[model samples]
Target: MNASDRTPADLLSSALAADPGRPLVTFYDDATGERVELSVATFANWVAKTANLLQDELSVEPGDRVALLLPAHWQTAVWLLACASVGVIADVAGDPAAADVAVSGPEPESLQAARACSGARIALALRPLGGRFPQVPEGFTDYAVEVPGQGDRFVPYAPVDPEEPGLIVAGREFSGAEVVERARAEAPELGLTGPGARILSALPYDTWEGLNAGLYGPLATDGSVVLCRNLDRLPGETVDQRIETERVTATAR
Candidate 1:
């Protein structure tokens, strides 16, 4: 059950087995004053449903490329794991035109970019409580609307190979095994030295460093992350207060 030699999906399964109720991802949107927390069980459930949606509804096969044109939101984190579970290569902030599937946020720029994808297109409203968009975007399935109808459990039709490409961030491709290895390697440097280390990250998800700090590093250590978006909008005092309130032991900014 150790994450050292396993894929991201295996790591998640191990985390769920270790403690389903433990908080895994705690997200904050400083601009919108939004905060949402997901326990390991809840996060895994979302990943399963999203993986089912990708596999059953979208018909995504192993090695398919999925462009993730989203920010560092909680739902975005779920999508990363779902892509891993379904054996799809997640291209974060990649060109939608070249992808087999594209996932976009509700922002106008992301929506505009997602329209180029000839394959399946999905959109997230990124609303509190995972609410659906008031009006679904053109040619895009609403994730919040579709995911809930999917089954709670997921099993990939094709087993995920750890050596297969799993993630692409900033145009750097990494296999499923490399993703886990990189996460583990970056954990200590990112101050995720021990289990239960709470890390507060203000970095964007577009870079390897950001992904490591915001998602993978903490996960590798069986720790939790306080992921912040638009953190620069908040005052220094407010940010400090949040660190104290969240019991953050480390910072990656």
Candidate 2:
């Protein structure tokens, strides 16, 4: 299916329909020794709950810009799809002051930027299991606290037009259609072709190239991602070990 009938959310739905048991995202944080693997159904469940949270709690609707101040984690991937599911623009590089909502990591910088958001500010602890921050920041709502209460199945309040702008990845904008088109092109570029292809990517999530590999590339091809943060900290032997352990077929460093 092409962009004419499918959005990124649709692609995910197809993946779930085809093989919900397959792993979609495998995340590793070298800094914290954390590893998380999410299957298509599991990831979709997280996305559904998150989408519900965005729609019901945050009052986010179509065309609303959400500043994503998170990192290269599984939850960030969930939020990206959640935003797409609700027709909200996921702005990875947006200014907090200009955004209607901001979802942030637990870093001081992210917390500070999220606090500056004029609209709803949400903080994610990014712990092993989406744990809440030890000391919740005053200006931000804890995502771990709010998301669990949201419905597991999400239905958008308004239908998302495929031509509507859906993502502001870095400084560039992509409509829902464009995102699917670009993913088709970028998937082969990132060697994320073939069924169940696994890519081990060490790139951060702040740029288009990173986002393409992390989210769109694999999803476009029914492939999976082993996203690595702080790659340089790992020894070369450890990297090789990961390639074997994670069953990675390609490397995108």
Candidate 3:
């Protein structure tokens, strides 16, 4: 399907229709070595709920920017799709100093930068962090415990325009906009679709390359993403084991 012909909602709907019972995401918690999985049906519902909360309760509007400081986990995937569903511009900034909202992990540097970031308004820290997100000095809202419960459905603020910017990624000296324009430009030849197609990505969610090439790209076509913590140091045998276990068909670095 073409970018102009479909919205992010369409992507999720199609995925659910194609394989509602298939696992869409599997997150491994390195701390306790626990595994959590979400089927397509569950993921679709979660995205809908999350989108509703962000749009209705948080007052996030279409084109409004929301940054995610989360690690490469299933929640990060949920947040990305949730933002997309409501036409909110998802800013995947590597450094919190470049973001508006920060979803922090256990990393103190990320937490500290999120607190110091100039434009930040909300900070989301996972429970495992022990609520240690650096105090959002004056003038900021600490959303560590303020997030609303998930709603049943999402009503998009506006129609998604392919030309509109979907995500913003900050570089060392400049930021780049990865709009649906680029997604359209790249989708056809990439074969980013179909049943039994799976993508394994270990890149951080805060990078446009990772978001587009890894997450949205696969979804845009009709595929699922398999997220891993880090692929750099894994032994070759372990890498093969992951691929076999997850039935991953492709990988994006």
Question: Stretches of candidate 3 above 4 Å error?
Answer: 1-5, 29-32, 94-100, 116-148, 171-193
Between candidates 2 and 3, the TM-score winner: 2
Off by over 4 Å in 1: 1-5
Q: What TM-score, computed on C-alpha atoms, does each candidate reach?
A: 0.98, 0.97, 0.75
Q: What global local distance difference test value does model 1 have?
A: 0.93
Pick by TM-score: 1 or 2, better one: 1
lDDT of model 2 at residue 118?
A: 86
Root-mean-square deviation of candidate 1: 1.0
Error of 2 at 171 (Å): 1.1
lDDT of each: 0.93, 0.89, 0.63
What is the alpha-carbon lDDT of model 2 when measured against the actual structure? 0.89
Model 3, backbone clash pairs (residues 3+ apart or across chains), number: 1
lDDT of candidate 1 over 121-213, digit per residue (tens): 999999988999999988989999999999999999999999999999997999999989989987888989888899999998999999889
Q: On a 0 to 1 TM-score scale, where does candidate 2 land against the true structure?
A: 0.97
Q: Backbone clashes in each candidate structure, one number apiece?
A: 0, 0, 1
Stretches > 4 Å off in candidate 2: 1-5
